[model samples]
Structures are given as C-alpha cells and as structure tokens.
Target chain A: MIIECRNLKKTYVADGQAVTAVDDVNLSIAAGDFAIILGHSGSGKTTLLSMIGGLTTPDSGEVLVNGIENWHQSDARLTEMRNQTIGFIFQFASLIPTLTALENILLPLSFGNRKAASSRQARDILAQVGLKDRENAFPAQLSGGQQRRIAIARAFINQPAIILADEPTGDLDEDTEQEILAVFHEYHRQGTTFVVVTHNVHLADSQESPRILHMRKGVLSEENPARTRAA
Target chain B: MQILARQINVLDYALSSLWRRRMKNLSVLLVFTAVIFLVASFQMTTGALTRTAERVLENAPQITLQRMSAGRQVDIPPEYAARLSSIYGISRIVPRVWGYYFDEVTGANLTVMGLATDRMPMGDQLHLALASGSFPGPGSRGSVVLGRAVNDMVQARGSHLLSLFRNDLSMASFEISGVFADATDILTRDLVVMNIDDARDLFRIRGDRATDLCVYVTNPNEINTIARKIADLLPDTRVVTRPQILKTYRVVFGWRSGFGSICLLTALTAFIILAWDKASGLSQEEKREIAILKVLGWQTADILAVRFWESLLVSGISFLVGVTLAFIHVAFFDAALFRPIMVGWSVIFPPFHLVPEMTAQVVLLIFCLSVLPYLAATVIPAWHTASVPADSALSGA
Candidate 1:
C-alpha cells in the first residue's frame, strides 16, 4: 500500500461546538492508482487531503506513508516527505506573482531539501508541461492555463511518488482542461499515484478513474450500485 | 576565509539591495555619519589638548618659587634673592618681577608673567634667538630682551635687552635690545622683556622685593631638597612644581576639556538616535526575509554576521567619508570643528598641524564600544525576527 490511514480522526471546536471533520476513517491506497475524492462544499475533503499531505495532523490514529508514521515523524522529516514524496498542485490562484515561470517551477527545489538532480527534473517537468520557452515570464504575464501548467511543473519538481491536486482544471476552458487531463493521464500511465478533488461530476464518473469516494457533511459514503453515474 | 568571502558576497548583495532603497538608508547613513564624525573630532581635539598640556608640562621648568600672602602668592622679598643666590646647588637665583602693564602707547595689556634674570636675561620660559633681534651676552646688565610678539605690540620702544638709564612709562620701555618668540603668555603675546632691575625700577622696588625667583637647580634630583631648603630659607614664601605653575593656565585648559565633553555628548546623543533609527526602521518584509533565511539552514551566527556586516559597512563607509571631509574642513579652511579657545582667539594653528592620532586601537574601540553595542542591541529584534516560523513569515509577506 502506498498510503495507510488507520482509524484517523480530526476534530474542530467551532463556536463552542465539537465538530468531527474526518471521523475514525480508515482507507488505503496502492501505487499507480489515479483516485478522485469527491465531496460537496464543507465536506472536509480538503481537510482530509491536508492531513494526508502532512500539512496538519489527525486527532488520533495513524497516517503511515510507506510505513513511516506521519504523526510520529519529526517536522523536518514531515517537510521532507512533503518536499520529496508528495506533490500538491494547488488551486488556480496559488502561483506566486513575483516569481517567473521557471522560478515558480523551481520553488520546491529551492527549499534546500532537494538534490541538484531534482533541479534538472524540474526543468524537464517544465518542458513536459510545454513551458520551455515561457520559463522567464512571470505569472501575471502568463495565461491562466499556462500559469496552471507552470504550477504543475512546480508540483512535479521533486518527482514525487504521489501528486495531490485540488481543482486543477476548475478555471480552464474546455480545450485547456483536456490538455491538463492529458498531462495527468500521461503521469498516471507512468505509474505515479494521483488524487484529485474536484466538482467535475463527469471526471468523478470516468471509467478509467480508480476508487472514487464521495463525501458529504464531513462524512464519506459508499456510492450505491443504483447510483451508477460514478465510476 | 571562504566563509568570510561568502559573507562579503552576501553583504554585497544586501548592500546593493539597500542601495535600491537609497533614500531611506541614505538619511539614516547621513545622520549616523554626522554623529560619528563629530564624536571622532571631539575625541581627537580633547586628545590633542591633553597632549599639548602634557608637552608643555613635560618641557616646563622642574622648579618654581611662589610667595604666599593671605592665600594669594605675593612677591618674594628681593633681599632673599641674594640670600637664595648663596643656597647650595642653586646655579642661579633669578629674581623676577612681573605685573600687568597697560601700555598707553600700544593700548595693549602686557602680562609680564616671567622676567629675564640679572646674568641670564631670558628666564626659564625663553630663548633669545627666537626674539627678532639679539639678546645681551653674559656681562650685560641693565639690558633687556623683548619678544618679537611683544615688540610688535609696543612699536619697538627699547634700544637694548636691558635699559637701566631711561624709563618710558607708556610701554614699559626699559632698554630691551633683543627680540624673542615661542614662549608666551595670554596678555604678553606682544611682550616686552627686560632685566630684573629695569622691572624693579619700573615697579619702583629698586632694592626692596621681586615677584618669584626663577631657580635653575644644579642637580635636578635635588629639587625636593632644594625646594625644601628654599621654602625653609624663605619662610615667608611657598614653592610649586612647573606643572602646578602651568596649572594656573587651567582656566584655558578647563574650558578646553569642558568644550570637548559637550561636543562629544552631543555626538554621543546623535549616535544613540542613529542606532535607534537603524533598529526601528527595518520593515516587516525584511524581517520575514531573515526568518526565511533562518529556516533555510542559515545558522543563528550567520544571520548575526549579516547584521554585523551591514552595520559595519554603513558605519565604515561613513567613517572614511566623514574623516576625510573633516580633515579637509580643518586642514584647508583653518577651522576646528569645535573651535579651540586659542583657535578662536586669532592664534593661527600651524597649517597641516592637526596632529590627531586615529589609532587602530581607537578605531576598534569606536566599533566595539559605540557601534557594537548598537549591533548587539539589534540582536533582540533580529533574533525575534529570525525565530518566526517560515509559514507565518511567507504567509505574512
């Protein structure tokens, strides 16, 4: 298994009321799986993703990434995992404005936690994303699709084993969306595990997508056979 | 050396970055520069004055005779001179008569602080060749020597080093034949030197009493013995060391030391303000940058080195520039930043003679005592900035 979550729980006290975000959930993901975590607004899908990314901690139980417990590892080791093992493609607006396309792509590698070989890999990722000549242009100068491509380049800079993206194609036109999905399909073909959270129902129901889990009101539910729209 | 090289490289980058924001840093640098320069000048001036005192004291007469009367020094009885002349190891008993004489002709108040003796005409404080003309030889009596500064003041009245026969009431003309320079008094910069008898005749104490006896000891080591013996022999008189005699000029030296203190205090206050401004004016973005650097494996000491170099570069540049500018101000313009009392009194200090010692030790002290405390003071805020988490730092900026 690539990721193992055993009885993971996250709770928040908001307005003096105890709210369970991820309640005693257990899940496992294998390598080479392109999974979609489907959820409505306020369903804690992003929160679950954050815990899985080691950006935050679960209240109890274990998040073991290749048998290394995220809860027990030092913050430095956790950051290393984030830097080396997991790549996050944030929403459309997450690109840094002051950074050029190449600099933005190299941001994760610039953290002093990666090898020089990873910098070469970052350049390769930029070229693969079709931003070879646009490296010097800043985000404001780039089109939204191009900016997302540079962000994708940044995400894969360390050649992480898993890529987690939140709404990677939410703001793109149909053509640009298909181009981005093609890049995802290409990475999935290369056996990199992928998890995407999106409101695209068609994407959630794709036949090739693996193990799509739907969430509502901070709780995950198994889709019924009667509800066959989901893949 | 490599670490220092890298530090200098970083300093160069930081300096260039600061240069991009010149207007802000320039004002701070100017204020800092002015304060440091003024402080340095004040230190140099005080140092010069103390050295001046030391030089004069070091070269002054080792022995002096003073008469005590009602808590003020009075004239030693002239009869005591002959008696003092007979004291053992006393090579000379130079009876001196000096009093303020406002010359009616020159309209100048001449301070006759020291007098020419009977055999040795110019007293311990003088050399006759330094006079404009000539001093009388060993046998000359009733001939007086006049300092060029004094002769110029009095319009060259006397015809000899000592004049026993004629008396001129207006300029104290008493046969002053020679002219001298170098040794001087405040009131007698334009001086009239004369034989002790001529001064005695002018003061109308022909055989009664003279002021102080300028004694030259045969054995300097016997000064205490001689001074004690003289004090006992002339029970009515008191004795003082040469520096003590020089201390009478303390009104001048006191004013000097006091002025130096005030200027330095002003400079120090300005230094405090400069340090305060440097500390308080660092922006949140700059602090965040430091925080990020710290998170990226920069050691605490490396960050401190950055601050140290930053301050040193600012102060060091300002120091060089300020000192250069002040040297021009003093050297070319004949100006003391804070005018010396002699400076303001129309005595032209010799050109190119501002012998200020800017020693490495002093430079180190200026950095260690003044600028280092300031750099260390910055540690609290810089450390506070460095201690901030990278996430908050990145997010805030």
Candidate 2:
C-alpha cells in the first residue's frame, strides 16, 4: 500500500470547546490508484489528508505511507519524506508572491538536491501546464487560474509517488476546473497515485474507475467500493 | 556541497522577501544604522584622543616639581633646582616658566611658555614641526613662535604681531616668528613660546623664582624612586611623574567617552525595543508565508536559515555603513557631532583630525553589542513559527 491509515483521529480545541475533526477513520490506497474524497466544509477530509502526508500528528492510531509509519520517523526524515515522497496542492493559489512562476515551480527542488537538468525540467513542466510564456510573471501579476497552474506545476516538480490535493480547484470557474482536472488526468495516466479531497462532487464523473469516498461530520464511508483498486 | 547550495537558495529567497517589504525594512535599517553610528563615533573619537595624548606625552619630562603653599600652587625658587641636582639619579634639572594668559579680546585662554634658549633646543626635544618661518632664535627677546590656532587668531586681526597686556596693564608687542604644523595642533593650538626673560618680564615674575622644575632621570626605571626622593626632600613640593600624567589623561578621556555613550543609551534602548517588537510580533502575512514554505516541504532548520540570512544581511550592511560613516566623521570631518562633548567646552577649541583606529577587538565588541542582539531577536520568533505543525499554522489555528 502506498498510503494506509487505521483508526486515525484528530481533535481541535476552538474557543474552549473540543471539536472532533477526524475520528476513527481507516483508509488504504494502492500504487497508481486514483482516490477522490468527497466532503462538504468542516467534514474532516483535509485533516485526514494532512495526517497521511505527515503534516499533522493523529491523536491516536497511526498513518503509514510507503510502509513507514508517518509519526514514527524523526522530524528530519519526515520532512524529507514530505519533500521527496508526497506532493501537495493546497486550496488557494499558494505561489510565493516574491517568486516568479518558474521560480515557484522550482521551489521544491530548492529544499532537496537539485540537479543541473532540473531547470530544464521545470521549464518543460511550465510548458506542459500551458504557462511557458508566463514563467517570468510573479504571482500577483497572474490571474487566479494562472497562479493555480503554477502551484500545480510546483507540486509536480519533485515527481513524488503520491499527490494529495485539497480543493485544488475550489475557487476556479467551471472551465478552469475542467482544465485543472485534465492536467490531473494526464499525470494520473503517467502512473502517479492521487488522493484528491474536494467538495465538488462533479469531479468524480471525470475519472474512470475512481474510488469515491464520502466524509460527513468526521465519519468516512465508501461510496464506490467496487471501483477501488485491490491492495 | 548540496547542503551549501540549498542554503544559498534559501538566502536568495530571503533577499527577495526583504526586498518585497523594502519600505518597512528600510526604516528599521536607518534607525539601526543611526544607533551604530552614535556608538562607533564615540568609541573612535575617544580612542584616537587617548592615543594622541600618549604620543604627545612620550617626550614629556620624567618628573615635574611644584611648590604648594597654603593649599595653592606658588612659584618655586630657581635655587631649588640646585637642591635637586645633588640627587644620584637626577640627570638634568631645568627650571621652566609658563603661565596662562586670558585674552579679553577673544575670550580665550592661551598658554605662554618661556623657552631656555641657551640650553638644548626645545624644538627638537618637543618635536615641534614648524609650518612656516622658524622658531625664536637664542637670545631673541622680541620674537615668539605661535601655534596654528593662535597664529590664525593673530592673522585674522590683520596683524603680523601678537600684542598682549603686561601685568601692569602695559601692552607688549612681539613679532610672530613662525606657526606650528597642523599635525601637532592638538597639543600646541593655544601655545605661545618665547624667550625665558621675555616671559618673566611679561608675567612680572621675580628673577630668582621659576614656575616649576622639569627633572629628567638617567634611568627611566628609577623615575618613581627619584620622584619619591624629591617628595621626601622637599616636603612642600608636589611631585608628578610622566606615567601619572598619562594615567590621568586616560581616565579623563575614558570617563568622557563613557558619559557620551550613556547619553546615547536612550536611543539604543529605543532601537532595541523596536527590534524586539518587530521580531517577536510576527505579522499574519509572515506567519502565512512560513506555513506555506513548510507545506512546500521546507524543514524548520531551513526556515531558520532563511531568517538568519535576513537578519545577517540587515545587520551586516548597517554595521559596514555606520562604521564607514564614523571613520569619515573622525578622520576627515574631525567628529564634529561628538568633539564638543568629548573635548569639553572651550572658546578656542582646536580642530584636530583624528586618525581612524579600528581594532579587531573593537569590531568584535560592536558586533556583539549591536548585531548579535538583533539576530537573537529574530531567531526566537522564527523558531516558534517554524516549529508549529504546517497544517495547524496553515489553518490559522
């Protein structure tokens, strides 16, 4: 299994009240599987994704990515795993405002060992995102859709085995959302395992044989178990 | 090599981040530079003054003897030199006559020294560099060697002669023989050297009495012993040694500079407070930026490295600029802002250029006092922000 979770739980204290974000959630994803988690706002989809990415520690249970327990590793090793083994696309256009589109795409490589050919690879990725001519533009200079594309390109620069996106097209127009979904399909065809969390249920229709799961009030239930890839 | 390259990349991003907030950072930089300038200027000026004092006093008399009667200094009889000549270690005894002349026209105090022309040349002994013309020759009674400042004052009045009122209110005029060089102006600015008889006549001194006795010793190591002997032999006399004079100058300059530093402490405290506030109170945008970087797989150490680079760039640039400006202020413009405070009040203040003396220890001290505090201020907040879980910070929890 590329990603696995057993009875994972997370609770947050807000205004002196304990709110359970994710409770007793169990999940497994195989290599090259396309899994779409459907949930409304405050449904704990992001919290579960964060645990699988080694971004948050679960209050109980454990998360295993690539057979290594996420919370069991040292901080350095976990950070390295996040950098090399998992890619994340946040809800907003999270490109660094001071960096140009190309530089933002190359941001992940800066944290790890960057090869001499990585610059060329970044330019190639920019061209693949149909933003080759906009590489020199800063985030502020780009439209929301262009900025999202740059962020998506940044996530793919390190070529991680797992791509976890949270509402990657949350605020985009219908056409822009379809454009981003098409880019995702292209990467999925190249055999990258994807676990995308979103409120847009229409995204499930774009994937063939996608394993769809529904999360409501911190509880997760499988909607398309027959489509799930056998692990 | 890969780690170094990664650090360089982070530093590049840090620079870009600072530039994005140029206006805010510029204000902090200006205040920081000003604080450094004030402290560095005081240090450099005081250091130069102390060194100049030591250099000028190197050729001073080994021991000076003055008579004290009724708790006031009185003229010692010239025959006292004869009494001191019998001491075993005493090499030569020279009775000197010098007094302060208050010029009513300029409201300045001038030092008038009487040179013994018949003995060894005082110019060579004191290293007096003549800027023009010559010193008063032996047996020359109506000629005087003027210091640079005194010469300027005399020449400003459109005269080639300096006229002074005698003790009896009678005016005496003397030809200006020469002007002292600018290099020696710090010591000679208010000095006027003339023949011994002319000084005695001007001051109305008795022929048998001299102002003081300058005693030289054959062995420098025996100076304190000789001074003690003279003090014991002449119980009414005050004995001062060269080392004692040097110590007094060091103490005076140190105290003055310390006072100047104290006066500037308020500004430094304000700056430190500003720095602390800026560092500890991370803006929401900055917090978000750190979160985004962490979510992009940057480690806490990487974030700290970026913050370290930012602080270092600000402080390093400020230090270089402040020290350079201070060097120019002391070496070229004569520390105009701090000279009056360090040198004290004087109507005829001598304008002397200070040699810029920056030692390794002084640079290190300034770095610790100014730069390290700012770096520490930045790192603590940076560590706090970086140590938070990326998801929690991104969620603004």
Candidate 3:
C-alpha cells in the first residue's frame, strides 16, 4: 500500500464544543490508484485527505506512508515525508503573491533537502502545464484558471508518490474543469496515486470504474460496489 | 551547502516581498533612521566636545590658585604671588586678573583678561593672534583687543568702543584696538584682552589685587607634588590642577551625555513598542502566505529564516543610512540643532570643527542599541506565528 490510515480520528474545539471531524476511519490506497472522496461542506473529506498527506496529525490513529508511520514521527521526519512522498493541492488561492508563477512552482524544492537542483524540472513542468508563457507573471496577474494550472504543476514538481487535492476544480468553468481533469489523467497514466476530495458529483461520476467513497458527518465508507478491497 | 544555497533563494524571495511593500516599509525605515540619527548625533557631539575640552586644557596653566573666603571666591593679593614663587618646584608665578564684564548692550558676559604686556609673549609667540589691527600696547591708554565674536557684536551695535559695566555701577569705555583671529575663537569667543592697568582701572581693583595666580612647574614629574604642597600651604585658597580640570569636564560631559541617552532610550522604547505591535499583528494575508509555504513543504526553520531576513534587511539599511546622515551633520554641519541643547550659553559656544571618532566598538554599540531591539521585536512574533501548524494557520485566515 502506498498510503494507509488506521482508526483515524480528529476532533476540533469550536466555540467550546468538541466537533468530531474524522471518526475511526480506516483507508488503504495502492500505488497508481486514482480515488475520489465525495462529500458536502463540513463533511470530513478535507480532514481525511490532510491526514493522509501528513499535513494534519490524527488525534488517535496512525497514518503510514510507505511503511513509515507519519503521525508518530518527528516533525522533521514528517516534513521529509511531505516533501519527498506527498503533495498537496489546496482549494483556495494559495500561490505566494510575491513570487512569480515559476518561482512558486520551484518553492517546494527550495525547502526540502533536495541535493539536486530543479531548474530543468521547473521548466519542463511549466511546459507540461501549458504555462510556459506565463512563468514570469505573478499570481495576481493570472486568471483563476491559469493560477489553478500553476497549482497543479507545483503539486507535480517533486514527483511524490501521492497527491492529495481538495476541490481542485472549485473555481473553474466546465471547460477548464475538463482540461484540468485531462491533465490529471495524463499524470495518472504515469502511476501517481491521487486522492481527490470534492463536492462535485460530476467529477465523482467521471471516474471510470473508480474506488469512490462517501464521507458524511465524519464517517467514511466505500460506495463503489465493484471495488470491495478491505484495509 | 545545499541548504545554504536554498536559503539564499529564500532571501531573494524575502527581498521581493519587502519590495512589494516598500511604501509601508519606507515609513518604518524613516522612523528607524531618525532614531539612529538622534542617538548617533548625541554620541558624536559629546565625544567631540570632550576631546576638544581636553585639547583646550593642554594650553592651560599647570596649577591655578584661587582665594576662597567664607565659601565665596575673592581676589587674591598680589603679594601671594611672591610667596608662591619661593616653592621648590615652582619655576614661575604669574598673577592674572580676569573677570566677567557684563555688556549692557549685548546682554552677554564678556571675559576681560588683563594682560601684563611687559611679561607676556609677543607676536607669533603669543597664543592669541591679531587678525588685522595690533594688540593694545602697554602705554596705549584705554585700548582693548577683542575676539571676533565680540568685535562683531560691538560693530553690530554701531560702536567701535566697548562699554563695560562693573558691579559697583562704574562704567569704562575702551577703544577697540584690534580683533583676535578666528583660529582662537573656540576659547576666546567672548574674550576682551586689555592691559593690566586699564583692566584694573575699569574694574575698580585697588592696590595690586589679582583674580588668581597661574603657577608654572619646572618639572612635569613634580606637578602633583607641587600641587599638593600648594593645597597645603594655601589653606585659604583653592588649587585647581590640570588633571582636576579635565576630570570636571569629564563629569559635566558624562552627565549631559547620560541624560541625552535616557531621552533617546525613551524614544527607542516607543519605537520598539511600535515595531512589536506591527510585527506581532501579522495581517491575514501574511498569515496565509506562511501557511501556503508550509503546505508547499517549507519547514518551520525556513519560515523563520524568511522573517529574520526581512527584519535584518530593514534594520541594517536603517542603521547605515542613519549613521551616515549623523556623521555628515556633526562633522560637517557642526550639529547646529543639537549644539544649542548640549551646549548651554550659546553665545560662548566653541567654534571648532568636530572630528568624528567612530570606532569598531562604537559601531557595535550602535548596532546593539538600534538593530538588536528591532530584531527582537520582529523575531518573537515570527516565531509565534511559525509555531502553528499549516493546517490550522490557514483555518484562522
């Protein structure tokens, strides 16, 4: 398994109330599996994806990536996992406003202990995302669709084993959404695991014979009848 | 080495970030520079004044004797000079009569130095040089040599003669014989040099009484011993040594300097408070920026380095600009604004050029007092913001 979660739970205190975000969720994803987690607002979709990506630790469970328990590891080791093994695509405008599009794409490699330089990789990824002409443009200068393309390109910069995307198509038109899905399909063909969390039912239906799961009120359960794989 | 190279890239990013907000940062920079300029100018002026005082005292007498009767200074008798001349280490004893003469027109006290022409050095051997006219000769009745400032004052009053008033309501008029050159203006800015007979007659000194005695020691090594003997022998008088004079100057300058520092420190404390408030209250956009970086796999240390570079760039530039402006103001323009406050009695001000004496130690002190507080102001807030996890940091925004 490329990623595994056992009895994952997370509770947040909002206004002096303990609101359970993720409850006893167990999940296992193999390499090259493109999975979609379907949920509405306030459902545990983002929280579950964040746990598997090593961004947020579960309150009472273990998140293992390539056999290394991420939650119990030191902060440095967890950061190493996030840098080398996992990538994230947030829903909002997350590009650093001060940096150019190319610089934003190159930001991940600038942080991690990556001995090798990434100038060539940065160029190639910009070309792949069809943003070669807009590399020097700041995020504020770009269209919403263009910025999302750059965010997708940044997530692919480190070539991590898994990519966790939360509502990647939240701000795109139908055509731009299709274009982004096509780009993801192209990378999915290259055996990168993708765990996408979104509320768009069309996106969930578009996946051909996919391992689709439903999350509502902090509980996650499989929905695809054809895929009955157990954790 | 790789991390260092990557940090350089982060520094580049930080530079761009600062430039993006240059207008806002410019205000902070200006205030920071003002704080530095104030502190540096105060320090430089005091240093120059202290050094100038020491140099001025170099030409002063080895030992001075003043009569103190009933806790008030009285004129010493001329006979005391002959008594002090018999001391073992005393080579020469010069009895000098000088007193403050109030100029009613100018409303400033002018120092009237009585010169015994026959015993005084002449021409280039004399410390005070005549700019144009010659010094008043011994037989030149009712004539006085004036300093440049005094000459300008008397000329401004449309009079070529100086009207000096005495405490006993007696007035004397002296013809302006000559003016001293500007080179001696520092010590003689308000001086009026005249013959002893004219000074005695103008000030109503009867029967050969002098203001004080200037003792010249034969050997430099025996100066302290001679001073001790004079103190013991002249129990009714006060003996002031050169070292004692220097010490008094040090105390005066130190007290004024400490007071100035306290004022600057208060302003500095206010600046630190402003900086701390600005830094600690990170905008929502800035918080989101940090969050995005963490999501992009940036470590806590990397975020901190970015903040550190930002603070350092602002403070470092401010320090350089402020100190440079202060140097130009003090060494070139003579610290015109601060001179009035630091130096009281503005009419008798020293007119010498200040030689800036900036050492590495001074630079380090400036750095600590100016730069370090700013860094602390920003860094503590940065550490607090960076301590939050990326997931929650975004949620707050």
The Cα local distance difference test for each model comes to 0.62, 0.83, 0.80
Better of 2 and 3 by lDDT: 2
- For candidate 2, the lDDT comes to 0.83
Clashing pairs in 3: none
Tell me the deviation in Å of residue B293 in model 3.
1.1
TM-score winner between 2 and 3, please give it.
Answer: 2
Candidate 1 runs further than 4 Å off: A1-231, B1-20, B68-312, B315-335, B340-353, B359-365, B393-397
Off by over 4 Å in 2: A14-18, A113-124, A130-133, A136-143, A228-231, B68-75, B86-89, B100-109, B116-125, B128-146, B151-183, B194-209, B218-229, B346-350, B393-397
DockQ, each predicted model: 0.10, 0.50, 0.40
Question: Candidate 3 at residue B175, lDDT?
Answer: 90
Over A152-195, each residue of candidate 2 has an lDDT whose tens digit, in order, gives: 88889899899999888877778878877888898898889999
| Model 1 CA lDDT for position B65 | 78
Lowest-lDDT window of 10 residues in candidate 3 chain B?
Answer: B119-128
lDDT (10s digit) by residue, model 1, range A155-206: 7766689988877777778877776777788888788898787767767543
Model 3 lDDT tens row, A46-92: 88888887878789998889988986788877877788787788876
lDDT of 3 by residue, B262-377 (tens): 99989988999899998899887788888777777777888888888999999999999989988898888887768766666443455544556576766788889999999999
Most TM-score-accurate candidate: 2
Q: Interface RMSD of the predictions, in order shown?
A: 6.3, 2.1, 2.3
**Ranking by lDDT, best first?**
2, 3, 1
